[model samples]
Target: MIHKAGRASRAAFRQADDEAFGAQQNGSMSKSMPTAVEAITGQNWQSIFVPKVNCCEVAHADRAAVLVDGANYFSHLEATLRRARHSIFIVGWDFDGRIRLRADQPADISPPLGALLRGLVEDRPELHVYILVWSVSVIHGPSATAPALLGSPWQDHPRIHMKLDTRHPLYAAHHQKIVCIDGRVAFSGGIDLTVRRWDRNSHRADDGERVDLDGTIYPPVHDIQMIVDAEAAAVLCRMAAERWSDATGEKPSSTAGKNDDIWPRQLPVQFRDVSVAIARTSPAYGGRAEISEIGTLTLDMIAAARTSIYIEAQYMTAPAVGDALAARLREPDGPEIMVVMTHTSKGLIERFAMASNRDRLIRRLAKADGHDRLRVVYPVVPSPQGQTQVLVHAKLIIIDDTLLRVGSANLNNRSIALDTECDLAIEARNEADRAAIAEIRNRLLAEHLDCAEADMAETIATEGGLIAAVDRLNVKMRGLRPFSAMRSPGPTRPIFGTSIFDPVRPFRLSLPFVSRGRSGAWRAPEKEL
Candidate 1:
């Protein structure tokens, strides 16, 4: 999460006491949305720059089961399937089973992930296990997936219908995190099973004791996951399936993977009392299917939140959405806003994606800052001895304990306007979840500041958010440099916390679309997990 306050002046974004600013949305929307916004805005909503769907009425649920994050590859997925007696369906940017699951499992018996998935298939032959992953390889790991010149076990699996999503643009990748079990449970958020995501709460600097079946230590990385059940998760599963059919020329699922209406489980089940809706930033669905769903969702959430908005993502470089948020903070009654994310710096490969277009988007929202209403911060696990940048990969956000979204989407153009991403949040008014989510946000902010979670929690409760809490503590981060060290020290440049939030814009974002070059994609031949 990079701070935009330093760049506030360059963009004419500043936050003074009791000053509020709002720009009416001027964009198109589905037939139903503008009517609703008229009730809120007291004017004819524009259907141009700001879409009308942004004001759609949201649904509140009763309760939901929790989804835990365990590097969410196959092993953890298998564990989820084993618990499901009803249904099983999957969607991903890609799903590979050549890896193991549990770090402490004995290796001699079978590769943890492959064997476990196999077990689920055999034990419950009646179960439907459908898997969908991205067709292209965008960012592959150092140890490439095992060469498939000879063929792999996944080719032989009978229950799995794994396919690549080709609906992506030539240079874009299908980036979504989704899992549906029996239509009763689902999980979405940023945690993926690719190599290097494994970590205990310890956030170890070194994988000294971590090992796969091959017995090697991978570097320590930090990430987050969103767990949910029933209505919330079901909605994501259905949307992912729709995308799979669009990408691979398959029909909508005969049974399990349709709109949430086909769900056997009734929604609005017990889960406190909050309005939760599913959001997406997929590429033109089929051909130019409108993307305002995600945009509307972000804006709606920002407006509804009366206390604060806490976002944690890998990339926080989306301008339009930033501008939306900036306007909200300018409101006299607007909520406190907190932005947290991985410190995104353009490496050689990432540089191509972080070009000027990216800068302009960031500048749009960054123009609104230095106000008491907005604060941005990033979390990093310090090296045991010194500060070595630990990439923060969690795509998370908590607004006033009233909203919590976790998934693979970053706040960027590609996510909201191009690539496919799945993110969900709990919009409950329940105290338990609200308290839990708020605590998690505070704990993460503490991680960035190198302070105890307990202390940060207190400060946040005192100041009402992680950013204000960090400021109140007056405890400069230990391993973390001031916001100036991450990028440029100048006020016009990105400060230490980058890609977290833009307080002046009219929207919020997922990470931007990842950029690619002519070297071509390194994907496994159409088979395998």
Candidate 2:
């Protein structure tokens, strides 16, 4: 029997669905084909990605840049931190103080991240640094560096306030990764300020610099970080403060002054004067209502695609997203879909749960692709020894060169409904914005193919589509390979594996086994086991 609260949720979702479908029907009836420039720039963006109610406010940024890999991101972050005059706030899933910031400097010249921050605080009397990390233990096997050191020296410095967030529901985590400096500039995306994340754009199969605190080498890792300034930076600072308050029960007032320019001088601006949308996902916990704007935005973007949908994520298992994609694929002239992901997951539970679900969704989408418009591949670069597949941990989506999104949320159930996530979406508002968005996508493709950006752009123009361009450029040396599905859980899936561990719906076992209702009514959730 459907519980009262479950019924209410279903009803609310049905209402949302009706509204979206109604809007789409109205949009379809319009007999107007916009010009290329108009379509790419101001193409009904407000209708496509509406702001989540009470989740995030629309903000403006004077400048924005997309840092492709951790190497560039960390270097720019270190530079910004070095020049931070008032305050610094970092919010992420994991953070390690031992990770070295400067790869080119000697040990004496370049200190560890912890030492660097400590020295900064000591040098600047007014500088106050705040770090908030998820309170969870993880064993990254030999692939990643040291285990996250969330204790001691991280909080030993009086000026550096460190907090392990435990305010989330059971098994749910605060997964938003953000960094703000002096309330003027902010960075957000999938990357955490941790070890084993530093790597050059080349993504060499065997790089000496990709080492742990103990000098142990790891595989190539890729991620994206979006930088923003002006009101966008202020919005991120406010998010940090809200999370800090939620975790520590202390409302930390912002020390950031408006109009302070903290954007790095060395970084190139990818887009100037762009409006950024900060979408979030936070489960209802500690008396707060759940926020799923990021999830909504993901689905809306997928539905809004007209030509192509390009995505790079760690995992793909959200049912709502999969259903939306399947519907789009069934359309006769639907957008071509291209997804880039890790060949396989690393953790045992993730492999069993996420991969199992991913394969299921892939099969579903494949069945819906009657026109053969779907392509899924993983990037692999060949070195002197053997083929090394670069791990695709980037959470990014590009829709028809008109919309670009980057964030910490994975294409997974947890990211949609459980963990806290933050994403920045930029709608192309002019020819420059469209060019920047396309350049970012082409640059990513070039990096994977180990080809020049100009060549990549030329090939894409020649081939007329990204998939065909990728197919033509893909060679044995360094190129994207079709993802081979790993062994799936098969027809009789075990409930204890996914349902209990990587649950689609975040549940609080310690609570009174009740779901909050709009009318203050409570009811038991549907039985999962």
Stretches of candidate 2 above 4 Å error? 1-47, 53-55, 138-150, 153-155, 258-260, 486-497, 508-529
Query: How much lDDT does each candidate structure score?
Result: 0.51, 0.75
Candidate 2, residues 233-293, lDDT tens digits: the string is 8899988988898889887645595434668889999899888889898877766877877
- Per-candidate count of clashing residue pairs (backbone under 3 Å): 59, 0
Which lDDT value does model 1 have at 49? Answer: 15
Candidate 1 lDDT over 153-216, as tens digits, reads 6545666565655565544556676777766556666765455555655555665645543667
Model 1 clashing-pair count: 59
RMSD list, candidates in order:
11.0, 7.5
TM-score to native of every candidate shown: 0.70, 0.86
Candidate 1 ranges with C-alpha deviation above 4 Å: 1-62, 65-78, 85-87, 108-111, 138-151, 209-216, 251-275, 328-335, 344-349, 355-367, 372-374, 430-433, 446-454, 463-465, 472-481, 485-529
The alpha-carbon root-mean-square deviation between model 1 and the true structure, to one decimal in Å, is 11.0
